[model samples]
Target chain A: MEINHTVIDSVPILAVSGRIDATTSRDLENALNGLIEEDNNRIIVDLAGVEYISSVGLRVMLAALKKVRPKQGDLMLASLQPFVREVFEITGFTKLFLICPDQREAISKMKTG
Target chain B: MMGINREITVPARLGEIPAISDFIYEVMSACGFDAKKIMEMQLAAEEACTNISNYAYEERNGQIHITAAAEDDLHLTLEDWGTPFDPTSRIAPVTESPAEERPIGGLGIYLIKNCVDEIHYQHRDGKNILKLVKNKD
Candidate 1:
């Protein structure tokens, strides 16, 4: 997977592409952890390029969310692929996350809420 | 459709998941599963095999053998010669609990259960066999 980081309106956005599995998730974990350590709390993960996500992949984000939430920060996932969205819905992860249909809404949430 | 038990054997490593997933797609497609159903099975397969690769073999290198058989329902049987551990023994995760309150790692088994219509697990001769069955749609 390829992860590119950019700042949008003071909110860090990670655009992740490729399939996320146990092995490839290291890059994502590193990216998220780096941002968290840097005190960039509220972040948006753009998964438009990500076509598939496994449970292990989900665990990385969940762990990061848990870590950042203590600082009153949250991780918002935006632009999920259809298959990925269905997996989240089936796993009931939609309740645990702030998922937006697009990056615009996620950035807005980071600013407004 | 009656299939003649298509199967593949690969090293039990995280990197082998893509090949396994491809094999799963082929078998499931041959058994006439839809796109969404095939993805569900693929996800479950990855989750199940991941547990085996992470915990079952430990320091020893092992191989994961998967068998796809469909006479009525599609059943993908994953067999590993690593230490016998029953992934299905774990109870379903409480999705009702707040995400902060829930554990992170247990989602694998829960997702494996949710993707399939029926699941069966057994240990025989130092092999852990997990059978994920999806009904024909």
Candidate 2:
């Protein structure tokens, strides 16, 4: 997966693309870990470019969420493709984290709340 | 419109997952499976292969063979000559539990079970064979 890191209104947005499966999930894990350490755990993963995500990806996101929540920060998701969104829904990831419809809404959630 | 059969064997490693998924998608789609069904099978195949890649061989190198046969229903079988483990026996995770209370992993088989109509496991001839089928109706 390709992750483009950008700061919008100081909220870090990781625009990820391609497939996040067993092999590529480690890269995502590292990126999230680095952001958690550098950006105070306030992060938004912009998945508009991502078309597929497997359980391995979900595991990474769940781990990151657990890490950031205790620090009073949150990891939000934005603009999921239908396939990826369905994976989240089937696996119950829809409840564990805050999933926004788009980047603007995710940034808005991070900024206002 | 269903007499398609395909088989491929690749190293049981994380890097080989894409190749496996590609083969599965092509075979499943050609069998007249819908995009949604193909995606689900791909996910299930990935989960099974991931388990094989990570835990099946256990610090050793082996191969996982995948066979797809489209008859009345789309049937897929994954055979691995690795550690003998009944992956289907794992209990499903309690998804209703709060995130923090839930464990970090163990969703592999649960997701696999959800993707297909039926799953059967057998350990015979020094191979762990997992067969999954999705009806064509």
Q: List the pairs of residues colliding in candidate 1.
A: none
Q: Which ten residues in a row have the lowest lDDT in candidate 1 chain A?
A: A86-95
Highest-TM-score candidate:
2
Candidate 1, residues A1-113, lDDT tens digits: the string is 99999998889999999989867898999999999999998999999999889987887999999998999999999999999998788778898899999999999988999
For all predicted structures, in order, the TM-scores are: 0.90, 0.93
State the lDDT of candidate 1 residue by residue for B1-137, as single tens digits: 45647889999988888999899888877777888888889999998888898778873689999999876678899999988888877646665875334443367877888889988999998899899999876
TM-score, candidate number 1: 0.90
Listing every candidate in turn, what is its Cα RMSD in Å to the true structure after a full C-alpha superposition? 2.2, 1.9
Best by lDDT: 1
Docking class of 1: medium
User: What DockQ does each candidate score versus the true complex, computed on alpha carbons?
Assistant: 0.57, 0.64
State the lDDT of candidate 2 residue by residue for B1-137, as single tens digits: 63998999999888898998899888877777788888888889998888776777874799999999996688899999998878777736655865334332257777787788999999999999999898867
Kindly give the stretch of ten consecutive residues in candidate 2 chain A with the minimal lDDT sum. Answer: A34-43
